[model samples]
Target: MCNALAFVEEPTDKHAKSDGYCGRILRAQTQGTRRDGYNEFRLRVEGDPENYQPASIYRVTLYASSPSYFRGFTLIALKEGTEGTRDDHYAGKFQIIDEEDTQFMTNCPPAVTESTPRRRTRIQVFWTAPPSGSGCVILKSVPFKKILILLQQLLHYYHYH
Candidate 1:
């Protein structure tokens, strides 16, 4: 049950992404499958994601644009070009930093998530690269923006009622 792929089923909700691609930072999520413009959220990696050595660790930071914050999120790393492929497995393991607020999910890719939602502008975590020969990886995430999250709750209430 901890495998957070959550229905992998399409969210029929009007607010959900039609393609069901949820949150892919580097992938092409548009009409022509081109990368979208930068959002208010940023996922910054301290090391070279393209040249990471086997079994190495890198610092990852998620920052929301000033005056904005998020309460929860899920982050995962996948090797480039492996999206939706049978080999689309997670490329590394995450080192938990805030045990009180964050946790590593037991999902197929063993991603990291918020254990207890907390509003904040930035969240940091460390990722250990996979074994030898693992190439560049793309960190992907779906951040629950604070205000939008509240809007979603209201929408859900109205939709259900």
Candidate 2:
């Protein structure tokens, strides 16, 4: 019963071909050392040019079979090619829901912000795996609108192992 989080990223382009969306699972790997009835894990996700667009915010949600085995989650955005600089361009937050799910919201900095938009190839999330052994975790992502748009148009299905 390894703990995990799955997620999906919708295509940035509304007119994208195919089903008009893309999804994937967040890969979980052992991180550091486990101690005090808690285990550390890192969830890594890659961004695809075909699915990701500049200046778009993606809402990622993590679902667990049971909340008792879940602990807490954190996201740390780091600057590219820098050792100690914190990147503020991207913003993210996590929320626990009904003891069964966790929602993560991430905002990508606007492409036009600094004359040159930074493209992120990867995102890293840190979480504490429950010692009680949670079954599995699922992560999903969808587009977040800053302007008026149909709520139905924003819905899509994506599943990852």
Candidate 3:
């Protein structure tokens, strides 16, 4: 699920680079990404994703086991389909927890991105779950790197009781 993701950001936004693709620089679509390193980085959600409360905030953390800092990053909340599949459209809205390091992307689903050209690890991005009956949500993230970037990745989830 991490290998296949893409989005466009407005060029006018000071925080946005507008590579036409937020993660992996969009060049991987033709060339290819660093396939040997998918698990090195991922987004981590801090609660029960399946039982998310309507209109509540959930904390999403960027986890990078790699020593490399990303050029940028983008996080999106995608609604889980009927059978754990992706719904195609974004699920809920994203909140910028670290205003100094992150900015909200102007997308219909409303994602968040890194404000600076380079970003450190473990920054948090908050998300508001959709209203009642919104079902489950899957948090996806793609760490941006112009060269030798890893593919997009889904969140590393920990179920809460």
RMSD list, candidates in order: 8.6, 19.4, 11.9
lDDT values, one for every candidate: 0.56, 0.26, 0.51
- How far off is model 2, as Cα RMSD? 19.4
Give the Cα-based TM-score of candidate 2 against the true structure: 0.24
Query: Least lDDT summed over 10 consecutive residues: which range in candidate 2?
Result: 22-31
Query: Taking the tens digit of each residue's C-alpha lDDT, what string does model 1 give over 110-160?
Result: 567677767877788888877766665667765664446534754565576
Candidate achieving higher lDDT, 2 or 3:
3
Per-residue lDDT tens digits of candidate 3, residues 1-161? 22111222211112212223333222222232444644545556675344666777778787666674566666666555421123344566777877888897643226677776665756787777776665556565666554222221211111210
TM-score of each: 0.63, 0.24, 0.59
Off by over 4 Å in 3: 1-38, 48-50, 81-88, 107-109, 147-161
Give the number of the best model, judged by lDDT: 1
* All candidates in order of lDDT, best leading: 1, 3, 2
Q: Which portions of model 2 show Cα errors greater than 4 Å?
A: 1-30, 33-51, 63-68, 82-84, 87-161
How does residue 150 of candidate 3 score in lDDT? 26
Ranked by TM-score, the better of candidates 2 and 3 is 3
Q: For model 2, state the Cα shift of residue 154 in Å.
A: 40
